[model samples]
Target chain A: MSNILEVRGLKVMYGKSIAIHDINISVPEGGIVTLIGSNGAGKSTTLNACLGTVPATEGKILFAGEDITHASTAERVRRGLVLAPEGRHLFPYLSVQKNLLLGATQRSDKEGIQRDMEFCFELFPILKDRLKQKAGTMSGGQQQMLAIARGIMANPKLLCLDEPSLGLAPAVIDDIGNKIREINQSKGTSILLVEQNVHLAFGAASYCYTLQVGEMVAEGSVEEIRNNDVVKKAYFGG
Target chain B: MGVIPNIMVNALVLASMYILASLGFAFIFNMLGSVNLAHGAFYMLAAYITYYLCAKAGLNNWVAMLLAAIVLAAIGIVMERFVFRPFQTEFDRVVMVSVALMTMLQQLAVQVSGSQTISIPAYGNGVLDLGFMTLTNEKLITFLVGLILLIITLYIVYRTKLGMQMEAISQDRLGAALQGIQVNKVAMLVCGMGFALAAVAGAMMGAYQQVSSNMGDNINVRILMLVMLAGAGSMNGILITGFLMALLDSVCPIIWDSYTASAIACSAVVVLLLIRPKGFFGHEM
Candidate 1:
């Protein structure tokens, strides 16, 4: 598979404090790549920088061989890079259908948008049933599902998800994990999964990277990372 | 019969103007989360521009009103780009800039117009007798114009793609940007629309009352009260509260002394705000 995203020596700072430092990662097209780390490990920061939400202090980000280091967030989305942020930032007051419609704001293809809306509804039938209901009134699990469905409406080439299983019950997490795998296998949509749940990450990702304090500590196949002592000690707590 | 008809006409007229002004303020406040203290100045500038174009520049009053709206909208775009854009999150700085702009506009108007009350020629000069009552043609025209504009504005807000983008931004700015909605462009459009709406209100009010340098001061207070009473970021609430305020404005004078009417209105808003904090239909509660 070809590399669809490349981050070279990226450094992101917030005022005087450094949020991420000298991080490099490459994601190949059509696979699940997970970045597993503890809290304050700069996983979310790296994802945000890739999406152009946070300005990088130095280095470059290339999407599909195109430099996107200085691109605006909206421009990044236009180029098919979409982020399903950590907090499931759905428009709380808006209806589920409206929230999904907003995801296709950049695309003018009304037919394609409509098809994608149906695809989302097919994936999560609950959303279709609650299409007119406000998003804030939904359950946490349903909101998570809606968030992923909203991302799919953008018709992204690469979807960056930040902790999709953050606070979900184990059963819900399993369902989400299966859906992520199904999305990757069926739709050929590449995913950059930033997650703390090692089991879920291991289950969903083929390639995995371990991040510690803004640096890539380990990068290998899932089986290799599972065998790494550091991964076992920190995440699996052996 | 006479008192009821008079009150109904008064309420409708006042409601029309209040909705016009409040909607403009609501647009800026909801989307950009800025107070836009210079909004009233924009309104005053529109009245003065209409005055200048009609009285001095030899333009038709209707044409001047349209021109004034366009001109103020252009100024609004420029201000959004240069003034409000840089001061996006700095609330106090934005407020200071707006206040300074308001002061400059007031001073400029005073210098140009010399503190005199000048009225734009009425759009209509006659009166219509409706069975038991009489209505000035100007009042009827103003009320109809306001209603038409309000319907158009509401249509643009609810039935257009731009409207969806505005609602999305107001709800979640970062999320909207992530979805490829241009924040800066939307902000500019919003500012232009806001100022244009205020300008229309100013021009119409100039015809109803007199255009003067300090005319904006009184309307500015009323605009603020309407927005607060409606609560920020609630379009439906704005529509509801606008009429409520207009009703208060029309009826209070009949129930209380003229001097105490505004005070009573203020007290009612305060009491309601204390009880609900987020107005009647606001989502933020």
Candidate 2:
């Protein structure tokens, strides 16, 4: 009934440049919201601000009704606001198992972590086979899967993903799309996905917000956004 | 009976001390991405502190080493929080800070302890006549101490949660932060461990050799060579290279003289460095 995550008047500046201005977005409880935009859009900046990796010039970010604008990235993560990041950011030298375990670094619940790790293995059996293998040795698709599964391992209440399908085969992108839906349905986890792949985002997310430059150009249900003439021309190639 | 046995024993002792000194140096380097020049300063201070605690305060040798370790560990924590953390991102600032620390500590040792040589009282006395080869209790104890500490250090780095976190931080700081790891907290622990290892090595070496103001100078250069040969951010690399250096240090002096040994070792390092800049066990620089 209530929004699980909210960002209001989120303004981010980079030296002399205004990266994002007055960006307002929200993810309702158990809702899957997708933010779609082009290269120079402020999608990544929004995610980074929410994670507190980049300091916000002006804004308020709310997680479960609590303002976490000033919290550190670790603090934000501890409170179940996790980001998988754009590049997958795997510790390449470390084994796959170590990377997965690091996902729950702040959590002390041993039993819960054990259960979640098992769940991750079940979700990505490829990962189970490559426990000792270095993550860097994996293919692009496998690495992306690991990054997403790593986010799940954190047991996040609101998982903010930045470009889950940036550089992957079409089949792998489809698998990721299905997995996102499956995660949303099964785990009831609220997700804020940022994507350049409009089809994958539209297929997975029930709600959609279109970002152009630094501002939200459109926001509505997936069907409503699909039918919009401006969005169709800009994103869907009408 | 022969210098061969003594040489072998000396190599092991030297390897252990070098390993101990470099282990902390490697940890700090991995965590901070800086070449901790003040590590030698910390090592020198620990030797001096242990000297005062044992020789001046009339404490037992083992007790003095333990006290010195705790004190140095505390100092390391303070340095990490106040000194290293502030200039963590700025390489130039860290260098300035570290150079200031090294110069100050080196001077402090010269002024307080003077240039005079003072040896720690032996933990035990007399030689163990083990049939063929005789052994001094001082060398035997120092070797044992070094071996045990090396094992402990290996255990802490290779088989612990803290170690995993350390590796994670070294490889990817942002990724570790995203996982809710308290990076600063982990850095403090590592900084303390680094200080503790250096302190222990300083104490053991001071007991074996005589403590002088310039004791840290040779060791400082030795550690630099060890770390460089090991490459950046490679723990196992340091271990292998440390053994190789100890071998050179021990056998060369026996074959020629100490100065000749130093010259040979330096030459070998320079040649190998040009061939493989990243060191033996390291990845791309």
Candidate 3:
């Protein structure tokens, strides 16, 4: 299958300091790919570069056969590249319904938007019940769910989730992992999930890339990454 | 006029005008996270434009005011694009740019209107004489127009999709962008709306009072106090504080002189800020 996204030799810089470098990653059509790393491993930075939030100083980003290296963030989002950013960067004061509606701000197809709204409700029913509730008032897990649901409302071609499992209970993490897989399988949407949680990454993603200190150190199928000695020692604390 | 009724009418007029002007200032402060010191100058400029159109161009008062508002709105969009957006994230630079803008606009107002104090014609020229109090048509019209404009603004802020996007953008800019919101686009519209509202207030006040070069200074200070006391992110706070501040200004004048009224009202604001440093409804920036 053709890749939905391909990043070649990507390098991102923060002033004189480098955030991520020498990064090459791809997400195949209708597949789940996770970039796993420890703190300060440039995982979120990589996702930011993809979403055009942070400029990539060096490299080419091709999405579905088109180069998007210098596109504005809004233009990129309009082209169906979306992110559920790290720490669930929700509009805390807004209601859940407004949050979801904001997710579809780029689109004008009313019917399609309604259909996606229903789909999001199905993916996380708690959101529908708390439609009028402030997003920040929800528990962490529910906020995460709302964050992802908000992303889904955009009906993205490639949904990049940044650390959805962060600050959640094990049970909630498991629930999120299942939702990730279900989203991919059911909608045939491509996903590039950035995670620190190796277990959730292993369960949800078919292909995995291990990032260490802003570099792509390893890339393989889930089983290979799961059994890799270095990944085990570093991420799993073996 | 009876002192009680006079004070009451004056308070209502002041409150409505202050509220209309400050609402725009608060939006700019909340959304761009910057202080546009030029906002007052913009207010003053609108008054001059309205005055020129009414006096020189021979347009009807309402049409002249509307045209002046449109002109300011267009200038507002340009300012947002060239002036405000570039320095949005740098608070110090934003203030500096606004101060420079304020100076330029003030100079322009002086150059156009000449240092002489000019005023717009009364919107209406009649009075309602009741047994208890007399109400001038001018004051009644000013208050009613201001109230109607305030209602429209509230409706736009609370009841529209664009308003929801605005709320989202104010709370979390990057998050709003990730949701595919054109942050700059929304901001530009907000700037236009804000300036338009300022223009309307300026024109209304121009009719109600004499227009001086430094008229913006007093109103700006009052707006700053209202926003500071209301806090950073709360519109409702501005709504409440606008009336309270106006009431203080109006009531104190009846007991003392205008100078003492100003002092008392300002001191009350200072004390309120001392009591709530973050403002009554503000969250952390």
Candidate 4:
């Protein structure tokens, strides 16, 4: 399968300090890829670089066939490259429906947007009843679901989610994991999930990459990553 | 007019005018997260422009007010693009730039019109009898027009797609950008709208009362109080607080001397702020 996203030798610096260096990642079309790392591992920096929020000091980010390293965040989003950022950054004071509508800002097709709204309701039925409720008032798990649903509303070719399972309960994490897989299987949308939750990441992603500090340490199938002694010991707690 | 009715009318008229002027100031404060110290200058400039158009340029008072709003809006867009955008997020530097802008505008006003006080020709002639009270046609027109504009402004804010975008940006700028809402473009439009609203209020007040180069200096304090007491991220609160502020302005003088009334009113606001630091209905910015 052709890769939907390719990040080659990506390096990001904040002033004199390097956030991430010499990093490469790819997500195949219709596949789920995850980057897993602990705190201070530069996972978010890498994700922000691909999203064009932070400037990449070196390297190229190619979306489908286009070199988008120099593109603006809005341009990247317009081309179906979307990021549901970490911390569940939903508009807290806004109603859930307005939050959902904001996600589809790039599109104008009323029918397509309506269809997507129904799809979201189907995926997370609780969201339907809470449509008029303020987003901030929702529970953590529901907020995380809304974040993913918001990203899906963008109708992205590649949806990059940062830490969807962070602070969610075990059962909620499992449900979110299933939804990530369901989205890929049903919608054929590519996903690039960045998580510190090893179990959730391993369950959702077919291919995985592990980063330590600012550099990639391993890249393999989920099965291969699960068996690797060093990665297993460090991340899996085995 | 009875004393009670006169006081009530004064409060209502003052509330409407201040609410119109403060809406723009509130928008810039919430959306840009910067204090536009030059906002009062925009108001002052509008009054002067309306005065010139009506008195010297042979235009109708209403037409001149509209023209003043347009001119100030154009200047606002230019200032947002060239002056404000670059210094955004640097609060101190932005304040300095706005203060500089205020001084320049004030100086220009003085050079053009000097220290002499001027007023626009009344929008309406004769008096309107409202049973218990009689009001000059000019005051009634100012009140009615100000109230209508305020309604239209609120409607645009609450019932429009562009308004939704503005709300999203004010809440979370990065989140708005992720949705492909162009921040700079929206910011420019907001600046233009803000100045236009201030212009209308200034022009209306010019006809109702008098205009001087330093008039903005006095109104600036009231604008600041309105926004600060309303807190951040809450536009609806401005309406309530605007009326409350006007009530204080109107009623306080009747009970005490002007100086004592000013002191008592400010002290009351300071006390209320102490009780609810986030104003009546606002979250942390």
Per-residue lDDT tens digits for candidate 2, residues B1-285, read: 578888888888888899888787788788778778888888888888889998889999889999999998998899889887888888888888888989999999888977778987766789998878998887788878878988887887789888888988888888887888888999999899889989998988888887777778778878999899988778888888888888889888877888998999878888888998888778541
lDDT scores of the candidates, listed in order: 0.88, 0.88, 0.89, 0.89
Residue A144 alpha-carbon offset, candidate 1, angstroms: 0.8
Candidate 3 Cα outliers beyond 4 Å, as residue runs: A229-238, B107-115, B129-132, B283-285
Let me know the TM-score candidate 4 reaches against the reference structure.
Answer: 0.93
Model 1: per-residue lDDT, tens digit, B149-224? 8998899889998998998888888888788889889989988887888898899889888898877886787788
Candidate 1, residues A1-238, lDDT tens digits: the string is: 6788999999999999988888988899997899999999899999999988899999999999999999999888888889999999889989999999999888889999999898888788999999999999999999999999999999999998999998999999999999898778877899999999988999999999998877778889999998999877776657
Residue A47: error of model 2 in Å? Answer: 1.3
**Candidate 4 deviates by what RMSD?**
2.3
Rank ordering of all candidates by TM-score, starting from the highest: 1, 2, 4, 3
Writing each residue's lDDT as its tens digit, candidate 3 over B1-285 gives 488778878989988999888877888888878788888888888888888898889999899999989999998899889877998788899888889888887887777778887899889899988778888999999999989999998898899878888888889989988887788999999999999998999999998987767878878998999889888889888888988888898899878999898999999999999999988987632
As a whole number from 0 to 100, the lDDT of residue B158 in candidate 4 is 90
What DockQ would you assign to candidate 4?
0.55
DockQ of each: 0.70, 0.62, 0.59, 0.55
Candidate 1 second chain TM? 0.95
The sequence of per-residue lDDT tens digits that candidate 3 reaches over residues A1-238 is 8999999999999999988999999899999999999999999999899888899999999988899999988888888888999988899988899889889887889999999989988999999999999899999999999999999888898999999999999999999999998999888889999998888888999999999889888899999988889888777667
Candidate 2, superposed: residue stretches over 4 Å from native: A15-17, A229-238
TM-score of the first chain alone, every candidate: 0.97, 0.98, 0.98, 0.98
In candidate 1, the residue pairs with backbone N, CA or C atoms under 3 Å apart (3 or more residues apart, or in different chains) clash, namely none
Per-residue lDDT of candidate 4, residues B143-228 (tens digit): 89989988888887899878888999888888888887888898899889989999998998887878888778767878888778
Q: Summarize candidate 4's per-residue lDDT along A142-206 as a digit string, tens digits.
A: 99999999998989999999999989899999999999998888889999999999889999999
